[model samples]
Target: MSFIASIGQGAINLYHRIRWVVSISTAIVQLAFHPSSWTKPVRAVLTRQIVFTGYDAIGFVAVVALLTGISVVVQAQVWMGRLGQSELLGPLLVTVIVREVGPLLVNFIVIGRSATAMAAELAGMKVRHEVEVLDSQGLDPLVFLVMPRAISMALSVFGLAMLFVVFSFGSGYLCGAFLGTGPGDPGIFARSVVRGVSSYDFYNILAKTLIPGLLTGVIAANEGLSVEGVATDIPQAVTRTVVRATLAVLVVSVIVSVLTYI
Candidate 1:
Protein backbone atom coordinates (compact mmCIF):
# COMPACT_ATOMS: atom_id res chain seq x y z
CA MET A 1 0.00 0.00 0.00
CA SER A 2 2.88 2.39 0.77
CA PHE A 3 4.50 1.62 -2.55
CA ILE A 4 1.24 2.14 -4.31
CA ALA A 5 0.75 5.49 -2.58
CA SER A 6 4.26 6.58 -3.54
CA ILE A 7 3.58 5.66 -7.16
CA GLY A 8 0.31 7.56 -7.06
CA GLN A 9 2.06 10.66 -5.75
CA GLY A 10 4.66 10.48 -8.46
CA ALA A 11 1.99 10.22 -11.11
CA ILE A 12 0.17 13.23 -9.69
CA ASN A 13 3.36 15.25 -9.76
CA LEU A 14 4.00 14.29 -13.36
CA TYR A 15 0.45 15.18 -14.29
CA HIS A 16 0.79 18.62 -12.72
CA ARG A 17 4.04 19.29 -14.53
CA ILE A 18 2.46 18.30 -17.83
CA ARG A 19 -0.59 20.45 -17.16
CA TRP A 20 1.60 23.46 -16.33
CA VAL A 21 3.50 23.12 -19.61
CA VAL A 22 0.33 22.75 -21.62
CA SER A 23 -1.32 25.72 -19.92
CA ILE A 24 1.65 27.99 -20.57
CA SER A 25 1.96 26.90 -24.20
CA THR A 26 -1.74 27.38 -24.79
CA ALA A 27 -1.65 30.86 -23.25
CA ILE A 28 1.32 31.82 -25.46
CA VAL A 29 -0.43 30.65 -28.61
CA GLN A 30 -3.63 32.37 -27.64
CA LEU A 31 -1.84 35.59 -26.88
CA ALA A 32 0.00 35.49 -30.21
CA PHE A 33 -3.18 35.03 -32.24
CA HIS A 34 -5.30 37.46 -30.26
CA PRO A 35 -3.58 40.76 -30.68
CA SER A 36 -6.86 42.62 -30.28
CA SER A 37 -6.99 41.47 -26.69
CA TRP A 38 -4.05 43.67 -26.00
CA THR A 39 -5.89 46.81 -27.02
CA LYS A 40 -7.16 49.88 -25.19
CA PRO A 41 -8.53 48.09 -22.17
CA VAL A 42 -5.26 46.26 -21.82
CA ARG A 43 -3.46 49.54 -22.10
CA ALA A 44 -5.42 50.83 -19.13
CA VAL A 45 -4.33 47.87 -17.08
CA LEU A 46 -0.78 48.41 -18.19
CA THR A 47 -0.99 52.01 -17.17
CA ARG A 48 -2.22 51.06 -13.74
CA GLN A 49 0.56 48.55 -13.40
CA ILE A 50 3.10 51.16 -14.37
CA VAL A 51 1.71 53.46 -11.74
CA PHE A 52 1.97 50.81 -9.10
CA THR A 53 5.19 49.17 -10.22
CA GLY A 54 7.09 52.16 -11.56
CA TYR A 55 5.86 55.48 -10.24
CA ASP A 56 5.01 54.34 -6.75
CA ALA A 57 8.34 52.56 -6.43
CA ILE A 58 10.44 55.34 -7.88
CA GLY A 59 11.70 56.54 -4.54
CA PHE A 60 12.91 53.09 -3.56
CA VAL A 61 14.56 52.59 -6.92
CA ALA A 62 16.28 55.94 -6.66
CA VAL A 63 17.59 55.26 -3.20
CA VAL A 64 18.84 51.79 -4.07
CA ALA A 65 20.46 52.98 -7.25
CA LEU A 66 22.11 55.85 -5.48
CA LEU A 67 23.64 53.58 -2.87
CA THR A 68 24.64 50.99 -5.47
CA GLY A 69 26.29 53.59 -7.66
CA ILE A 70 28.10 55.15 -4.76
CA SER A 71 29.39 51.76 -3.63
CA VAL A 72 30.57 50.73 -7.09
CA VAL A 73 32.23 54.06 -7.81
CA VAL A 74 34.05 54.07 -4.50
CA GLN A 75 35.33 50.57 -5.04
CA ALA A 76 36.24 51.26 -8.64
CA GLN A 77 38.02 54.45 -7.61
CA VAL A 78 40.08 52.63 -5.07
CA TRP A 79 41.03 49.87 -7.47
CA MET A 80 41.83 52.27 -10.30
CA GLY A 81 43.84 54.46 -8.02
CA ARG A 82 45.98 51.51 -7.03
CA LEU A 83 46.52 50.53 -10.66
CA GLY A 84 47.10 54.20 -11.71
CA GLN A 85 44.34 53.80 -14.35
CA SER A 86 41.81 56.24 -12.92
CA GLU A 87 40.72 57.19 -16.42
CA LEU A 88 39.10 53.78 -16.81
CA LEU A 89 36.35 54.74 -14.35
CA GLY A 90 33.98 56.10 -16.96
CA PRO A 91 34.07 53.08 -19.22
CA LEU A 92 33.93 50.64 -16.35
CA LEU A 93 30.92 52.35 -14.77
CA VAL A 94 29.06 52.41 -18.06
CA THR A 95 29.77 48.76 -18.76
CA VAL A 96 28.80 47.60 -15.30
CA ILE A 97 25.60 49.64 -15.21
CA VAL A 98 24.44 48.73 -18.71
CA ARG A 99 25.43 45.08 -18.85
CA GLU A 100 24.71 43.80 -15.37
CA VAL A 101 23.57 46.01 -12.51
CA GLY A 102 20.80 47.86 -14.29
CA PRO A 103 18.77 44.85 -15.34
CA LEU A 104 19.39 42.96 -12.13
CA LEU A 105 18.40 45.86 -9.94
CA VAL A 106 15.27 46.66 -11.92
CA ASN A 107 14.25 43.03 -11.82
CA PHE A 108 14.71 42.95 -8.08
CA ILE A 109 12.46 45.94 -7.72
CA VAL A 110 9.79 44.45 -9.97
CA ILE A 111 9.88 41.11 -8.22
CA GLY A 112 9.47 42.76 -4.88
CA ARG A 113 6.75 45.17 -5.87
CA SER A 114 4.85 44.19 -9.03
CA ALA A 115 5.22 40.44 -9.25
CA THR A 116 4.33 39.72 -5.67
CA ALA A 117 1.35 42.04 -5.77
CA MET A 118 0.14 40.45 -8.98
CA ALA A 119 0.36 37.05 -7.39
CA ALA A 120 -1.53 38.14 -4.31
CA GLU A 121 -4.23 39.93 -6.28
CA LEU A 122 -4.76 36.98 -8.58
CA ALA A 123 -4.75 34.58 -5.70
CA GLY A 124 -7.38 36.67 -3.99
CA MET A 125 -9.45 36.70 -7.16
CA LYS A 126 -9.19 32.97 -7.31
CA VAL A 127 -10.20 32.62 -3.72
CA ARG A 128 -13.19 34.88 -4.24
CA HIS A 129 -14.20 33.00 -7.41
CA GLU A 130 -13.87 36.11 -9.57
CA VAL A 131 -11.63 34.38 -12.09
CA GLU A 132 -14.13 31.60 -12.50
CA VAL A 133 -16.95 34.07 -12.87
CA LEU A 134 -15.14 35.77 -15.69
CA ASP A 135 -14.54 32.46 -17.38
CA SER A 136 -18.12 31.44 -16.94
CA GLN A 137 -19.20 34.70 -18.50
CA GLY A 138 -17.19 33.70 -21.61
CA LEU A 139 -14.46 36.25 -20.92
CA ASP A 140 -10.93 35.15 -21.52
CA PRO A 141 -9.28 35.83 -18.19
CA LEU A 142 -5.79 35.68 -19.66
CA VAL A 143 -6.64 38.44 -22.08
CA PHE A 144 -8.79 40.56 -19.82
CA LEU A 145 -6.50 40.15 -16.85
CA VAL A 146 -3.10 38.55 -17.35
CA MET A 147 -1.98 40.08 -20.66
CA PRO A 148 -2.16 43.65 -19.38
CA ARG A 149 -0.12 42.85 -16.35
CA ALA A 150 2.45 41.08 -18.48
CA ILE A 151 2.78 43.96 -20.93
CA SER A 152 2.97 46.44 -18.11
CA MET A 153 5.67 44.49 -16.36
CA ALA A 154 7.77 44.29 -19.50
CA LEU A 155 7.46 47.98 -20.31
CA SER A 156 7.90 49.00 -16.69
CA VAL A 157 11.05 46.96 -16.35
CA PHE A 158 12.51 48.54 -19.46
CA GLY A 159 11.63 52.01 -18.25
CA LEU A 160 12.93 51.41 -14.75
CA ALA A 161 16.16 50.02 -16.10
CA MET A 162 16.73 53.19 -18.07
CA LEU A 163 15.94 55.22 -14.98
CA PHE A 164 18.36 53.14 -12.98
CA VAL A 165 21.13 53.87 -15.46
CA VAL A 166 20.52 57.56 -15.12
CA PHE A 167 20.39 57.51 -11.35
CA SER A 168 23.39 55.23 -11.06
CA PHE A 169 25.56 57.31 -13.40
CA GLY A 170 24.54 60.58 -11.79
CA SER A 171 25.06 59.36 -8.25
CA GLY A 172 28.30 57.63 -9.10
CA TYR A 173 29.66 60.80 -10.72
CA LEU A 174 28.65 62.93 -7.78
CA CYS A 175 30.15 60.53 -5.26
CA GLY A 176 33.37 60.13 -7.19
CA ALA A 177 33.73 63.87 -7.65
CA PHE A 178 33.17 64.41 -3.94
CA LEU A 179 35.88 61.87 -3.25
CA GLY A 180 38.32 63.88 -5.40
CA THR A 181 38.35 61.38 -8.27
CA GLY A 182 39.33 63.23 -11.46
CA PRO A 183 38.05 60.60 -13.86
CA GLY A 184 34.48 60.79 -12.58
CA ASP A 185 33.62 63.21 -15.32
CA PRO A 186 29.99 63.02 -16.43
CA GLY A 187 30.91 63.93 -20.00
CA ILE A 188 33.31 61.03 -20.30
CA PHE A 189 30.80 58.70 -18.69
CA ALA A 190 28.14 59.77 -21.16
CA ARG A 191 30.47 59.23 -24.10
CA SER A 192 31.58 55.84 -22.83
CA VAL A 193 27.93 54.81 -22.37
CA VAL A 194 27.10 55.85 -25.91
CA ARG A 195 30.10 54.00 -27.24
CA GLY A 196 29.84 50.86 -25.09
CA VAL A 197 26.11 50.27 -25.37
CA SER A 198 25.14 49.13 -28.84
CA SER A 199 21.87 48.09 -30.38
CA TYR A 200 22.71 44.54 -29.39
CA ASP A 201 22.91 45.56 -25.76
CA PHE A 202 19.51 47.16 -25.95
CA TYR A 203 18.08 44.05 -27.57
CA ASN A 204 19.59 41.89 -24.88
CA ILE A 205 18.17 44.06 -22.13
CA LEU A 206 14.73 44.07 -23.70
CA ALA A 207 14.78 40.32 -24.09
CA LYS A 208 15.77 39.93 -20.48
CA THR A 209 13.02 42.22 -19.28
CA LEU A 210 10.35 40.78 -21.59
CA ILE A 211 10.91 37.11 -20.90
CA PRO A 212 10.91 37.59 -17.15
CA GLY A 213 7.79 39.70 -17.37
CA LEU A 214 5.95 36.99 -19.24
CA LEU A 215 7.21 34.33 -16.90
CA THR A 216 6.12 36.24 -13.82
CA GLY A 217 2.70 36.92 -15.25
CA VAL A 218 2.11 33.33 -16.29
CA ILE A 219 3.42 31.91 -13.07
CA ALA A 220 1.31 34.21 -10.95
CA ALA A 221 -1.78 33.55 -13.01
CA ASN A 222 -1.23 29.84 -12.85
CA GLU A 223 -0.80 29.92 -9.12
CA GLY A 224 -3.96 31.96 -8.75
CA LEU A 225 -5.88 29.70 -11.08
CA SER A 226 -4.67 26.63 -9.28
CA VAL A 227 -5.84 27.62 -5.84
CA GLU A 228 -8.15 25.11 -4.25
CA GLY A 229 -9.26 23.95 -0.77
CA VAL A 230 -9.06 26.34 2.17
CA ALA A 231 -8.92 30.15 2.24
CA THR A 232 -5.36 29.89 3.48
CA ASP A 233 -4.42 28.41 0.13
CA ILE A 234 -4.53 31.83 -1.48
CA PRO A 235 -1.63 33.22 0.44
CA GLN A 236 0.25 29.98 0.07
CA ALA A 237 -0.22 30.08 -3.68
CA VAL A 238 0.95 33.68 -3.79
CA THR A 239 4.07 32.81 -1.87
CA ARG A 240 4.80 29.90 -4.16
CA THR A 241 4.18 32.02 -7.23
CA VAL A 242 6.60 34.72 -6.10
CA VAL A 243 9.31 32.19 -5.33
CA ARG A 244 8.85 30.37 -8.62
CA ALA A 245 8.65 33.54 -10.63
CA THR A 246 11.79 34.93 -9.06
CA LEU A 247 13.70 31.71 -9.71
CA ALA A 248 12.49 31.56 -13.28
CA VAL A 249 13.57 35.15 -13.89
CA LEU A 250 17.03 34.53 -12.47
CA VAL A 251 17.53 31.35 -14.47
CA VAL A 252 16.33 32.88 -17.73
CA SER A 253 18.41 36.01 -17.19
CA VAL A 254 21.58 33.95 -16.75
CA ILE A 255 20.82 31.78 -19.76
CA VAL A 256 20.13 34.77 -21.98
CA SER A 257 23.25 36.58 -20.79
CA VAL A 258 25.36 33.53 -21.53
CA LEU A 259 23.80 33.07 -24.95
CA THR A 260 24.32 36.73 -25.80
CA TYR A 261 27.98 36.53 -24.84
CA ILE A 262 28.41 33.38 -26.88
Candidate 2:
Protein backbone atom coordinates (compact mmCIF):
# COMPACT_ATOMS: atom_id res chain seq x y z
CA MET A 1 0.00 0.00 0.00
CA SER A 2 2.87 2.38 0.80
CA PHE A 3 4.62 1.52 -2.49
CA ILE A 4 1.35 1.97 -4.38
CA ALA A 5 0.91 5.41 -2.83
CA SER A 6 4.46 6.39 -3.82
CA ILE A 7 3.83 5.29 -7.42
CA GLY A 8 0.62 7.31 -7.53
CA GLN A 9 2.40 10.38 -6.22
CA GLY A 10 5.15 9.98 -8.80
CA ALA A 11 2.61 9.85 -11.58
CA ILE A 12 0.92 12.96 -10.25
CA ASN A 13 4.26 14.76 -10.09
CA LEU A 14 5.03 13.87 -13.68
CA TYR A 15 1.64 15.12 -14.78
CA HIS A 16 2.21 18.44 -13.00
CA ARG A 17 5.64 18.90 -14.57
CA ILE A 18 4.24 18.32 -18.04
CA ARG A 19 1.37 20.66 -17.26
CA TRP A 20 3.78 23.35 -16.11
CA VAL A 21 5.80 23.13 -19.29
CA VAL A 22 2.65 23.46 -21.36
CA SER A 23 1.43 26.39 -19.27
CA ILE A 24 4.61 28.35 -19.74
CA SER A 25 4.69 27.64 -23.49
CA THR A 26 1.12 28.86 -23.80
CA ALA A 27 1.88 31.88 -21.62
CA ILE A 28 4.81 32.83 -23.81
CA VAL A 29 2.67 32.85 -26.95
CA GLN A 30 -0.17 34.74 -25.27
CA LEU A 31 2.23 37.23 -23.77
CA ALA A 32 3.82 37.82 -27.17
CA PHE A 33 0.44 38.79 -28.55
CA HIS A 34 -0.12 41.24 -25.68
CA PRO A 35 0.95 44.90 -26.02
CA SER A 36 2.17 45.50 -22.48
CA SER A 37 4.55 42.61 -22.52
CA TRP A 38 7.14 44.87 -24.13
CA THR A 39 7.24 47.74 -21.67
CA LYS A 40 10.46 49.60 -20.87
CA PRO A 41 11.35 47.50 -17.84
CA VAL A 42 10.69 44.25 -19.67
CA ARG A 43 12.63 45.49 -22.70
CA ALA A 44 15.56 46.23 -20.44
CA VAL A 45 15.34 42.76 -18.98
CA LEU A 46 15.22 41.26 -22.46
CA THR A 47 18.30 43.22 -23.47
CA ARG A 48 20.10 41.99 -20.39
CA GLN A 49 19.11 38.44 -21.14
CA ILE A 50 20.47 38.75 -24.69
CA VAL A 51 23.69 40.21 -23.35
CA PHE A 52 24.10 37.36 -20.91
CA THR A 53 22.81 34.45 -22.96
CA GLY A 54 24.10 35.57 -26.36
CA TYR A 55 26.93 38.10 -26.26
CA ASP A 56 28.75 37.12 -23.08
CA ALA A 57 28.56 33.46 -24.05
CA ILE A 58 30.33 34.03 -27.38
CA GLY A 59 33.80 33.53 -25.96
CA PHE A 60 33.04 30.06 -24.65
CA VAL A 61 31.04 29.14 -27.74
CA ALA A 62 33.78 30.30 -30.05
CA VAL A 63 36.47 28.43 -28.15
CA VAL A 64 34.47 25.22 -28.12
CA ALA A 65 33.54 25.61 -31.79
CA LEU A 66 37.13 26.29 -32.80
CA LEU A 67 38.45 23.26 -30.99
CA THR A 68 35.71 21.03 -32.31
CA GLY A 69 36.15 22.33 -35.84
CA ILE A 70 39.89 21.93 -35.83
CA SER A 71 39.79 18.43 -34.37
CA VAL A 72 36.98 17.12 -36.56
CA VAL A 73 38.36 18.61 -39.76
CA VAL A 74 41.87 17.40 -39.06
CA GLN A 75 40.66 13.89 -38.31
CA ALA A 76 38.40 13.88 -41.35
CA GLN A 77 41.35 14.90 -43.52
CA VAL A 78 43.44 12.05 -42.20
CA TRP A 79 40.76 9.44 -42.73
CA MET A 80 39.69 10.78 -46.10
CA GLY A 81 43.30 10.81 -47.23
CA ARG A 82 43.58 7.12 -46.45
CA LEU A 83 40.20 6.32 -48.01
CA GLY A 84 40.63 8.62 -51.03
CA GLN A 85 37.46 10.51 -50.11
CA SER A 86 39.16 13.81 -49.38
CA GLU A 87 36.72 15.76 -51.57
CA LEU A 88 33.92 14.84 -49.21
CA LEU A 89 35.55 16.87 -46.46
CA GLY A 90 33.57 19.97 -47.31
CA PRO A 91 30.21 18.21 -47.22
CA LEU A 92 31.20 16.46 -44.03
CA LEU A 93 31.98 19.75 -42.32
CA VAL A 94 28.76 21.35 -43.47
CA THR A 95 26.59 18.43 -42.43
CA VAL A 96 28.27 17.88 -39.07
CA ILE A 97 29.40 21.34 -38.01
CA VAL A 98 26.91 23.74 -39.53
CA ARG A 99 23.73 21.73 -39.29
CA GLU A 100 24.20 19.72 -36.12
CA VAL A 101 27.02 20.84 -33.88
CA GLY A 102 26.41 24.57 -34.15
CA PRO A 103 22.83 24.53 -32.96
CA LEU A 104 23.36 21.91 -30.25
CA LEU A 105 26.55 23.46 -28.89
CA VAL A 106 25.15 26.98 -28.68
CA ASN A 107 22.00 25.78 -26.91
CA PHE A 108 24.02 23.60 -24.53
CA ILE A 109 26.08 26.60 -23.50
CA VAL A 110 22.94 28.68 -22.99
CA ILE A 111 21.40 25.85 -21.02
CA GLY A 112 24.39 25.73 -18.71
CA ARG A 113 24.62 29.48 -18.27
CA SER A 114 21.25 31.20 -18.60
CA ALA A 115 18.82 28.37 -17.93
CA THR A 116 20.32 27.60 -14.52
CA ALA A 117 20.43 31.27 -13.60
CA MET A 118 16.84 31.82 -14.75
CA ALA A 119 15.58 28.92 -12.69
CA ALA A 120 17.40 30.09 -9.59
CA GLU A 121 16.31 33.71 -10.01
CA LEU A 122 12.67 32.77 -10.41
CA ALA A 123 12.90 30.33 -7.54
CA GLY A 124 14.44 33.03 -5.36
CA MET A 125 11.66 35.44 -6.29
CA LYS A 126 9.06 32.81 -5.47
CA VAL A 127 10.55 32.02 -2.07
CA ARG A 128 10.56 35.70 -1.20
CA HIS A 129 6.86 35.93 -2.10
CA GLU A 130 7.71 38.36 -4.85
CA VAL A 131 5.42 36.63 -7.34
CA GLU A 132 2.47 37.03 -5.01
CA VAL A 133 3.45 40.64 -4.50
CA LEU A 134 3.38 41.20 -8.24
CA ASP A 135 0.00 39.47 -8.41
CA SER A 136 -1.40 41.79 -5.79
CA GLN A 137 -0.19 44.75 -7.85
CA GLY A 138 -2.33 43.51 -10.78
CA LEU A 139 0.72 42.45 -12.75
CA ASP A 140 0.53 39.39 -14.89
CA PRO A 141 3.81 37.76 -13.95
CA LEU A 142 3.83 35.83 -17.20
CA VAL A 143 3.90 38.98 -19.28
CA PHE A 144 6.23 40.93 -16.99
CA LEU A 145 8.63 38.07 -16.58
CA VAL A 146 8.41 35.18 -19.00
CA MET A 147 7.80 36.82 -22.38
CA PRO A 148 10.93 38.94 -22.53
CA ARG A 149 13.01 35.98 -21.57
CA ALA A 150 11.42 33.82 -24.25
CA ILE A 151 11.94 36.44 -26.94
CA SER A 152 15.45 37.31 -25.85
CA MET A 153 16.53 33.73 -25.43
CA ALA A 154 15.03 32.70 -28.76
CA LEU A 155 16.74 35.53 -30.62
CA SER A 156 19.95 35.07 -28.71
CA VAL A 157 20.16 31.36 -29.38
CA PHE A 158 19.55 31.87 -33.09
CA GLY A 159 22.19 34.60 -33.22
CA LEU A 160 24.69 32.60 -31.20
CA ALA A 161 24.08 29.52 -33.29
CA MET A 162 24.96 31.49 -36.41
CA LEU A 163 28.09 32.84 -34.75
CA PHE A 164 29.10 29.39 -33.60
CA VAL A 165 28.64 27.90 -37.06
CA VAL A 166 30.64 30.73 -38.63
CA PHE A 167 33.47 30.22 -36.20
CA SER A 168 33.38 26.50 -36.77
CA PHE A 169 33.60 27.02 -40.53
CA GLY A 170 36.48 29.47 -40.10
CA SER A 171 38.34 27.13 -37.79
CA GLY A 172 37.77 24.21 -40.12
CA TYR A 173 39.10 26.22 -43.03
CA LEU A 174 42.14 27.30 -41.06
CA CYS A 175 42.85 23.74 -40.06
CA GLY A 176 42.29 22.59 -43.62
CA ALA A 177 44.95 25.02 -44.80
CA PHE A 178 47.58 23.19 -42.81
CA LEU A 179 46.13 19.74 -42.24
CA GLY A 180 44.29 19.09 -45.51
CA THR A 181 45.42 19.56 -49.12
CA GLY A 182 44.42 23.24 -49.26
CA PRO A 183 47.59 24.98 -48.17
CA GLY A 184 46.80 28.50 -49.49
CA ASP A 185 43.32 28.29 -51.03
CA PRO A 186 40.88 29.14 -48.28
CA GLY A 187 38.30 30.46 -50.77
CA ILE A 188 38.15 27.13 -52.55
CA PHE A 189 37.51 25.31 -49.27
CA ALA A 190 34.82 27.83 -48.37
CA ARG A 191 33.08 27.28 -51.67
CA SER A 192 33.23 23.56 -51.23
CA VAL A 193 31.59 23.84 -47.81
CA VAL A 194 28.93 26.09 -49.27
CA ARG A 195 28.08 23.69 -52.03
CA GLY A 196 27.69 20.93 -49.51
CA VAL A 197 24.81 22.65 -47.74
CA SER A 198 21.32 22.82 -49.27
CA SER A 199 18.51 25.31 -48.72
CA TYR A 200 16.54 22.76 -46.74
CA ASP A 201 19.56 22.23 -44.53
CA PHE A 202 19.68 25.92 -43.69
CA TYR A 203 16.00 26.10 -42.82
CA ASN A 204 16.28 22.94 -40.77
CA ILE A 205 19.16 24.33 -38.79
CA LEU A 206 17.21 27.51 -38.08
CA ALA A 207 14.17 25.55 -36.99
CA LYS A 208 16.23 23.41 -34.64
CA THR A 209 18.02 26.39 -33.12
CA LEU A 210 14.88 28.48 -32.77
CA ILE A 211 12.77 25.75 -31.19
CA PRO A 212 15.39 24.83 -28.61
CA GLY A 213 15.93 28.43 -27.64
CA LEU A 214 12.21 29.07 -27.18
CA LEU A 215 11.61 25.84 -25.31
CA THR A 216 14.60 26.49 -23.07
CA GLY A 217 13.08 29.69 -21.74
CA VAL A 218 9.76 27.95 -21.30
CA ILE A 219 11.30 25.04 -19.38
CA ALA A 220 13.40 27.33 -17.22
CA ALA A 221 10.44 29.56 -16.51
CA ASN A 222 8.33 26.55 -15.63
CA GLU A 223 10.91 25.11 -13.27
CA GLY A 224 11.72 28.43 -11.68
CA LEU A 225 8.11 29.46 -11.20
CA SER A 226 7.18 26.04 -9.87
CA VAL A 227 9.59 26.20 -6.99
CA GLU A 228 7.97 25.83 -3.59
CA GLY A 229 8.99 25.42 0.04
CA VAL A 230 12.34 26.49 1.51
CA ALA A 231 15.53 27.94 0.05
CA THR A 232 16.77 24.41 -0.59
CA ASP A 233 14.14 24.08 -3.27
CA ILE A 234 15.98 26.61 -5.45
CA PRO A 235 18.92 24.30 -6.09
CA GLN A 236 16.62 21.48 -7.06
CA ALA A 237 14.75 23.77 -9.41
CA VAL A 238 18.04 24.88 -10.96
CA THR A 239 19.09 21.27 -11.45
CA ARG A 240 15.77 20.37 -12.98
CA THR A 241 15.97 23.34 -15.29
CA VAL A 242 19.35 22.32 -16.62
CA VAL A 243 18.52 18.65 -16.94
CA ARG A 244 15.09 19.14 -18.43
CA ALA A 245 16.06 21.91 -20.83
CA THR A 246 19.09 20.05 -22.12
CA LEU A 247 17.12 16.86 -22.64
CA ALA A 248 14.32 18.71 -24.35
CA VAL A 249 16.71 20.53 -26.67
CA LEU A 250 18.54 17.32 -27.56
CA VAL A 251 15.30 15.56 -28.27
CA VAL A 252 14.18 18.41 -30.46
CA SER A 253 17.51 18.43 -32.24
CA VAL A 254 17.24 14.74 -33.03
CA ILE A 255 13.71 15.08 -34.30
CA VAL A 256 14.67 18.02 -36.47
CA SER A 257 17.69 16.22 -37.78
CA VAL A 258 15.66 13.17 -38.72
CA LEU A 259 13.11 15.26 -40.55
CA THR A 260 15.76 17.42 -42.22
CA TYR A 261 17.95 14.53 -43.19
CA ILE A 262 15.06 12.55 -44.52
Index of the highest-TM-score prediction:
2
The list of candidate 1 runs beyond 4 A from truth reads 1-35, 182-184
- Runs off by more than 4 Å, candidate 2: 1-16, 180-183
For candidate 1, the lDDT comes to 0.75
* Decoy 2 TM-score against native: 0.90
What tens-digit string does per-residue lDDT give for candidate 2 at 1-262? 9999999999999888778776777778777877867888778888898898888988998899898878776676667667887678778877888788889988998999898998899889999999999889877788777888877888889998888888877786687677544434777677777788889887887887878898899888878888885789999999988888998898889898899867
Provide the lDDT at 82 for model 1.
84
Lowest lDDT block of 10, candidate 2: 175-184
Residue 233 lDDT, candidate 2, scale 0-100? 92
The lDDT per prediction is 0.75, 0.83
lDDT of 1 by residue, 1-262 (tens): 9999999999999678647745774676478467677677666876898798778888888898899888886687678778987666656766677767888778877887877778778878877888889889766787777777766676788888888888877787788779876355668656755666667687778877767766776777677767774578877877887787778778778887887778
